[model samples]
Target: MKGKNKHNKLKPIMKKSMLAALSLGIALPVAGSLPHALAGAIEPTINISRPVLNDDIYWLSHSSEQVDALPIMPSMPIGVDNNTIIIDLSTHFSSDRFTQLGAISENTNVARAYVTNDNKLVVVPYRSGKINIQLQAKNALSPEGEMIRDNIELYISKKGDLNGDDKVDSADAVQLYNYLRNMVTRRGFSYVEKNQADVDRNGEPELADMNALLSGYANQSLGAKDNSYVLTFKQVDDAPYALNGKLNGDLKVGATLTSNIEFFDPDGDTPRSMLYQWYRGSEASGEGKTEIIGATEAVYKITAAEQEKYLFLQVTPQSYSSDRPQGNPVVLRSESTVAVKQEDIVSLSPSNGSTEVKTNAPLVITYNRPVKINMNSFSSIIIRNLTSNQIEANYIFFLGNNFRANDNKVIIDNPGLKYGANYSIEVSNDAIIAADPDDNAYMQGTVVEQNGVQWTFTTQIPQ
Candidate 1:
């Protein structure tokens, strides 16, 4: 293919060769080993030498908790940093990323989701069985994780209009029941009913469904005029700041994660406008003033805005009112410790568990503790394959640390990876800040355990 992109979203076909064997019983045709029937499918044996698989003992915090181990929920507004209301969705479905025909996903963000000030939920949607759902947050976790458990009870479902009364009802069972009789809930083709109908589907709108509808419908506030729709909140910190001044404010990212206020105007039938702004403040000498204003559509970076995370003080997308409240400020700092030492691996592209690396994605390097060095020199990052312990000309890119106003992290693109092979990502941090080339700012970092990072992921063709 002369001018075609050799990396045109390679979709490897695991050619069948023989039965595979695995301790976990996953038989790879060539690589993995499991004892099973021989359809004779051969997978490209990675022979990766098992790069430290303590699972939780290896890499990123989220991976350790196995957050992305399951499907996600859909029907959520990606961003929401408003001050007043944090929308709840536990009244309906059990999860966000659903493996169904009607599943939805956002182009940005995922796993552990956030609500942009504009009132849209950005999340990574996954699928299982015959349904698909969005992972309402950036990462997924099992029920045992302490952090994930605290918020497990949050998030109510948004698809319970059973009575056809333009409102959720107690008898939606009848609807599902009737649908099961003739109408299909899978939203599948004519034959889809044979595959997706709830002959034994997991909890298909059962008593659980009835109860959720009953509770939500029973609530009086829901009946009030001006129905409340989901709104998104976003970080708006790109406005110019003086040298060594604050960008937004002291924004905390834990249990009390906060977003500035932004409201949307209500249209017909819709209650409450989603338009508002947060209180803006200055950390200058005795500078204590705040105001309401519009919010940005997404998170913006303050590359030159000194070392402080700013939070929305007050939101006034709506008309001003004394009763209206303000949001908290956010002071940005590296929350996670950079455990990875040296440029151990940058995975120019999809090497380990990462799935969305682009040829132009920002160069995101993880470390054991927070890094305070400068990375302004190295022209870019590179992805290379390991054939006989030698670095091969697999792929390369120049993803220096160029902060974008609207991005939280940088993605490096086309660090060329081999089809069905393991590779190491190399990031010359010193090059990132090597002003004169000699002073490469290579900081001493730590290695996150295997569980800390997603070391593997499957790829799909660009549909």
Candidate 2:
């Protein structure tokens, strides 16, 4: 059970390499029925054929020519010399199973495998390089569990062999760069294949990986370089605004706004990539905001609908410094207010001179632009019951009592007008009607005067 468990655990880890080896006919044979002489008087020995790289088989962006299997003689007698096998393999996994952290050949320095009791052999490469595959077995003439051993060598290519030409050069760097920039969408390469360009092993191929290749290609040519470096990225926050032109403050509807990051690299001298996202909301703050779709560029145009709304720009910076693999982008949010011409109630409830209104009906007011009101000054605005010669405060709501204010307009609960009463709601210039202070159209002491800002309505019979 222990052996079975270990095999199961290692099988998945070896699936990729195993598939390549199997396709190439290099996998070991099962020990189900060993040489007939094993149980006979003659001792049986195991002999394996040397594996040769075909080099003719090729696949998308890689060569499928790895030694897949080694022919073995299960019934051969002992005393035959075992041959040395050499496999020139690339670091790209035959299958994606090489995606694990320890699967890189440069890390493990060798491949590993074990001979199963059933005469089967399993191999897994820890890292690309000269790896040894050792097998153990015992002849029937010896103890029941006694065994002989042999080893095979596997030479893995260095990382950054992007083109699989067995060399790391400017070509690999160009491929990696184009891929990162999204220029090569159908490169016929799988995820693992592209990962080979992560020469610095920073989890992904970025600017630093390209730099590593360019910096180490000479050493690689000399057969002394591994194209490995400590992947590190410094933490970078949203950069300050460069204020290329004017930013923030008041922007009129239909006007254009442009801005960008100040462009300072935390690595002191390295260049970093930056992106932008624009948001729209009612407040200068980002709460209750929505991203402006397709608003990723630095320049933005204010729409008439955006009047009285706030536009916030968030800048994100990306870095591909090998020393900063764990580094994350920092975001900075800046804002501008869209100034709209002062707006007032473009429309009102209970149309002026309206009669037969329900005693309980609410007064609704709608505006072209959102407005602000100072409920404290409600007293100055009155609804007079002219039929009864009484102030609205005498029978209806008082200051701070029955009015609701929103961005665009206000709603007032029924003043409980007596049935058949004629009432006139008046607003002097002193009435507290104004656009929110945050709005561009906001003014101090006047309500919208479309119809002189006063209206009279008569209540229907009490129901």
Candidate 3:
């Protein structure tokens, strides 16, 4: 009764005194008068002792594979503030005496808060953001019980603290650089680590971010405030330009011409595509030029229609990533105008069937345009005596002694002829070959026949 009688005698009296104080609008100190066991049931004032209530908390959001858990907490010195906060209770309530001890974060997505079994408040940050947490303690102070509450703000930031040492220093810079270059064993960066490494806040970790971190670290060492270092970047772009351009093939009909053009870009971008246009002009100066129809490739074949016309190639470089997609067009003309595809015999000396022929005159064949006589085929020329029914001269007789080629004519030294002889000159179809001077396009000579008869002439009778 001594143990039970004391508490039993004060229960009704204390309840009536609390009711009387409440009716008279006067506060009563019931906790002082109650028994220790009864006072322990009152709600205790919740206080966050480690981190000041008005001071904001900072935490590193970097995740590491080497660590045991994600969002690895920084290793702080003895006095440094950290994510863990000590929960303190009033004198009336002990740690285990509270009915309930819990914590809730206002923004659970950014951060979360929980109270450990030993009344330690721990904050787990997910990303870079701010969150407010309310710490609560409940006990049976009245019929419905009373709730004690306190709030603490948490600032979760990347801050380039990659090593989880709570400092953005050179060590963090090296780690971030190695991670970006894949020099680390773990090649990939976690979401939180990426946020931490992206010092410029451009949504991705890159070389620029690493450089920014270095600058930030240097500024921090110089007594600059936290997050005072900022970096801004701009993309550089330049247009492509032609270095040198020219036509690579012969400037004549029936020949293939190639465009030899080189292009360069100041911004180091390659040409995504190129446009080629082959033009025909009257002069080698590239004036009065007209694009050849259907000639759009890097190579163009000269046709018969382009004979005697100069050719020019215009190349336009194009790039998709350049600030100027289309570069200046480079126009290069062929060295010379196109020449005739084949040479044609325009005139014959001493007429086709002359009745009077001078014995000292040279036999000549002239062409309409300049031509290259195939010295290799010179042995095919032949002259026969039709009247005497015998060979007058053979190719062997006139190999180098009587054959001479001028600009557009082939001259043969006059062969000794008998007086009053009906002589005929027979040149084989391919004996006199005519070739273009520019591109070497050749054509065999046609048989010289006058009214169903070979080239026959009557030499003057001996005087």
Which candidate should be chosen as best, given TM-score against the real structure?
A: 3
lDDT of each: 0.27, 0.43, 0.52
Tell me the spans in candidate 1 whose CA falls farther than 4 Å from its real position: 1-281, 284-295, 298-310, 317-366, 369-380, 383-463
C-alpha positional error of residue 142 in candidate 2 after TM-score superposition, expressed in Å: 99
- Encode model 3's per-residue lDDT on 1-463: one tens digit a residue: 0000000010112223323323332222232231111101111211111211111111211111111122333311111134333333222134543557778988987566787776555554544455667756664433334454444455454355565544455566556655665523344433435445666655455556555655554445211234221111111344555545667766555466877655554333557668888899887787688988889898887776788888888888877642467777777778887877553567677666897776655677787756554656544556666678888776542355666667778776677776777766655543544355444433335353333445567777767
- Estimate TM-scores for all models: 0.17, 0.24, 0.31
Q: Evaluate candidate 3 by giving its C-alpha RMSD to the native, one decimal.
A: 30.1
Give a tens-digit lDDT track for model 1, residues 109-204: 222344444333333211111212232321112222111111111111113333323333334334533443332223332212211112121213
The top-ranked prediction according to lDDT is 3
- Model 2 quality (TM-score): 0.24
Better of 2 and 3 by lDDT: 3
Over 1-463, each residue of candidate 2 has an lDDT whose tens digit, in order, gives: 0000000010112224323323332222232221111111111211121111111112111112222321221111111123212222212121122111111122233444443333333334333344444332222231232222222233443455555444445455556555555422333433334345556554444445545555455444311233221111011222221112224434765345666444433222234555777788886656898888988877776666677777777665445444432223333344556666454446657776788888777776676666555544434556688899888653122455566667776666666778898887655433334454533332222233543445677888756
Residue 332 lDDT in candidate 2: 34
Error of 1 at 151 (Å): 38
**lDDT, model 2:** 0.43
**Candidate structures ordered by lDDT, highest first:** 3, 2, 1
